[model samples]
Target: MGTIWTPKLNSYSGAKYLRLAQAAADAINQKELLANTKLPPQRRLADALGVTVGTVTRAYAVLEQRGYVYAKVGAGTFVRAEESEFKNKQINFATCQPPLTNQISVLSDAMSQLAKSPQRLTQLMAYHGEPLKEHQLIFSQWLHKRGITQQPEQIVFTHGAQQGIFAVLNGLMQAGDTLLCEGNCYPGIHTAAVQLGINIEPITLSDEGLDLSELEQKIIAHQPKVLYITPNNQNPTCIQYNLSQRQAILALTKKYNLVILEDDVNYCLSSEWHSPIWSIEQGSEQSEDPGHVIYLSSLSKVFCGGLRQGFLLVPNLYALKIKQAIHSQCWMISPLNTELACRVIQNPEFMGQREQVIAQRQQLCIEMGQRLGLKQRWRGLNGWLQLALPLKAHHVVTALAQKNILVRNGDDFNNHQNFIRLSIGDAADDKIFVQQLAIIEACIKSLSQTAYSVV
Candidate 1:
C-alpha cells in the first residue's frame, strides 16, 4: 500500500469530510488504487490531517460498515484485496458476457472443421469490401428468426453494436443535435453520443416503457433528431415494452418526424421477442414513408464478444448515409469474425446451447429473487436488483468490491434508483452463484443493522 488515503480537508466542499472519505474508499474500490492495501490508523491519520481522532474514527466506521474495510483483533484495519477479500472468492457479475465454456467448446469444433477445408480457410483471408453481400445475406437469414427481415443492401457490418451505434448516430446527427432516450439508457449510447458532440435528453421511464407524456414533452422541447431505444429487456431495469407502449412511442416519433434508432442487441437472449419499432414502422403501409427506424444488433452478447461482429438494419432511405459512415470508420468488419459469427448462428446445436444458457440465467435469477425476497426481475442474460441500501450505492459497491463480488451500481447507468445489475454471464456454476448472492445478502443486512444502530 502506498499510504492510507488522507483527504485534504480544506479542498473538499463539505465540512463533514464524510463524502471525502467515501470518495477515497470509492477510488480504492474501483481499483484506481491497489487492493489488499492498508489504510492509516485513526490516530495516525488524524495527526497528519490536523483533525481529531473522532472524525477519522467516524470515517473508518462508515468504511467498515459499508464493506470497504475491516478490523482485526490485533492487526490494523486494511483496505480489502479483491482476489482474496471475501471468504467465498470473487464472482464477476460486473461485465455482461455469456459464459464461455460452451461457446469455446462449440467454436473449437467449428474451427477444427473449418481448418480441414483449405478453400474456406483461403476465403477467410480475402477482404470482401464494404457491405459484404454474401455475409449480409447470411445475417439477414439469421435475423429472420427474431422477426427482423431486411434486404442484403440494407445491412452494414460493424465491429460490434457499440460501433454500429456510433456510426449511425454520427451519420444521422450533426454536432449539437439533440438525441432522446430513456433517462437510464445504456452507457455505450451515452458514450457514443458524447463523442460525436450530440446532446442527449432523457425521457421519463415507467413499467410499460418510456413515459409517453414525458417523451412527447422532451420531443417538443429538444427537437431531437434521433431516439435510441432498447425496447426488449432494456438495460439496467430489464423492463420490456408491450404492444401498446410500442405503438405509443411510434406514434410520438412519427408525429415529431424523429428517427428511431432501435438497439435490440440483446434480443437474441430474450425468451420471447417483442416486436421492435422497426417492425412496427415496416408493417405500417399507411405511412407515406416507413423508413423511420434504424435497427442495430450484434452477436457479442449471445455469441462471442471476441468476434466483435454487429450488423445494422438501416432504413432504405438512410442506407447510403450509413454505408458512407461505415466506410469512413473501418470499411468493414473482419471477414474472419463474420465467418465465425455466421458459422455459430448456422450451427443447429447453438440454439440448444442458447437454451441452456438462458436456463442457467433464469435459475440464478429465481434463486436471487427468492433469497432477497423480491420477484425475479430478469430478462435474457441480465437481472436488476433494486437494493434497499442503508448506505449510498457507492458505499455498497465498494463494500461488495471488498468482498470480491463485482456488480454494477444503478448510478453507473444514470439510474438514481438503488439497483445493481446481476449478469448471469460471469457466474459459471449454480453453487457459486448462490454463494455469491448469500454474501451480498449478508452485506446488505449488516449495513442495514449498522444504519439502525447509528440512528
Candidate 2:
C-alpha cells in the first residue's frame, strides 16, 4: 500500500517510537489515512521508514496500548474498527483500589474451602449482628502482627474503614462538635463530617506531617472532640509522619486532652518505620495513658475491596459506646465477609502479595517521576504533583480526561493549591502506564506553552 502516514520525531515527545505512534494516530484521526486500514509488517515498516525492526515493534506496541490499532495472530496490524468508541473509554487514575484478580483468586480458594463445611457456612450466613468475640479475636490476631496490641473485647467491626470513621465520629462527637485533620484530608472524612453536622478544621501541614504549633492552636480554639488522622501513606499526599512529628503530636495530645482517631487504613503498604501512631504513642516514653488514640484498620485495601471488612481498635473505655453506635447504624458487618477477610489474612501468601503490589507501585512512582522530569519519588498508590504552570488544577485534569486518561485534582482532597494526584495503581501493566505518562507529559507541556503565550 502507498505510504499511510509519515512518522514524525520531536524532542518534546520523548522516545522516537512513541513519537512515531502519536504521529500515526494524529494522521489517522485527521483523515490523512482511513480508519480500519491495514499496516505493513514490522520488518517491511522498518525498511520503509529506515529504522530497525525493534523500533517498529515498539511503535506498534504503543499504538496498541493507545487503542489506535490491533494485530491478528496471523495477519498484519490494522486500524481499530471502533476508533470513537475506544477514545471514550476512560483510563481511570483517580481512585485507589487493590488489584482484583489475585485477590479474587485468593478469596475464591478460601470460599471453596468454607463451602466444604456446610455447618460453618450456614452459621456465617446467619445474622448474628452483634459483635462476635470470635470474629474480633481473629481480626485482633491479624493486627497484632502489624505491631498493634488489642484484644477481642476492644475490637468492633464495621462495613469498612469509612464506616469505622463514621462510627468514631458519631459515637465520640456530638452534633456541632469540632474535629481537626491535616490540611489535605481524605474526601470521605470531609463528606462524613458534613453529613453529621460536625465542624472540621484543617490543620496546616509542614515538611514534617502536621504543623505542631498550628495543631495546638486549633485544639485550643476548637477543643475538637477527636483528631482524625491518616499517619502512614496518608491519602492524596502519601505523607508519613516522622518520629519527631509523632512525638510532638503525642505531647500536644496530653496537654490538650485530645482524643485521636487514627485512620490506619493504608498501614499494610506502609514501611516498617511508618508504624501506626497508636503504636507509637503506646511505646513512647512520654505517654502515660493508652486510651487517647482510637485505632481503625480495614481489609479493603490490603485483601479485597468487595469484602468491605473493617475493624476499630477502640480503647477499653470507649468500646461499649462505639459498639452501641455500630449496632444502631449497620447492626454488624457481614460475618461472611469478615470470615473471608480473616481467612485471607491467615493465608501464607498474604504478606508476599501485599509487598509485591506495593513494590510495583513504588517503582511506578519512580518511573513516572523520571518520565515527567521530576526528582521526587512518592510512595503508595497515589503520587502528588504540585504544578508550576499558570493553569488551574481542574483545567489540567480536564485536558487529561480529553486524552482518555483520568486523574484526581488535589483540591478534591481539600488542597487549596494547584496539584494533581496520579493513582499509580491505575495502569494494568507497565507498557500502558508508560504510554499514559507520555500522554500526560505532552499535555502538560502543551498547556504550559499556551499559558506562557497568554501571559
Candidate whose TM-score is highest:
2
Candidate 2: residue 22 Cα off by (Å): 27
Q: Using Cα atoms with residue i matched to residue i, what is each candidate's TM-score against the true structure?
A: 0.76, 0.77
Candidate 2 per-residue C-alpha lDDT over 1-455 given as tens digits, one digit per residue, 9 for 90 to 100 = 53455455653253455556767777666766566788777787777778888667766775775567887888778787754555456777787765422454456558888989899998888888676677778777877886686667778888889999988888888889998998888889988899899998998776568988889988999988799878777777777788888777877887788788988776335553366778876676765557788888788766656688888877777877887788888776788877777788887656434456557766766675676564342656667777665656787799888788999998787786778887755554445566677787777766766645231
Q: Which 10-residue window of candidate 2 scores lowest in summed lDDT?
A: 97-106
lDDT of each: 0.74, 0.73
> Candidate 1: where is the Cα deviation over 4 Å?
1-89, 267-270, 374-376, 389-391, 452-455
Best by lDDT: 1
RMSD of each: 17.1, 9.9
Deviation in Å, model 1, residue 412 alpha carbon: 0.6
Candidate 1 lDDT by residue in tens digits, 1-455? 23656665555433343544656666675676566567777788788878888667666665664456777756776776655434465678788877643455457557877889889889778877765577788888877776775677778888999999988888889999999988798999989988989988888888899988888888888899899998987887888988999888888888888888988887335556677888887788777668778988888777678878888888778888877787788875688777777778787656434556567666756675676564347877788777664555566678889888898998999888777777777654344566677777777666655654221
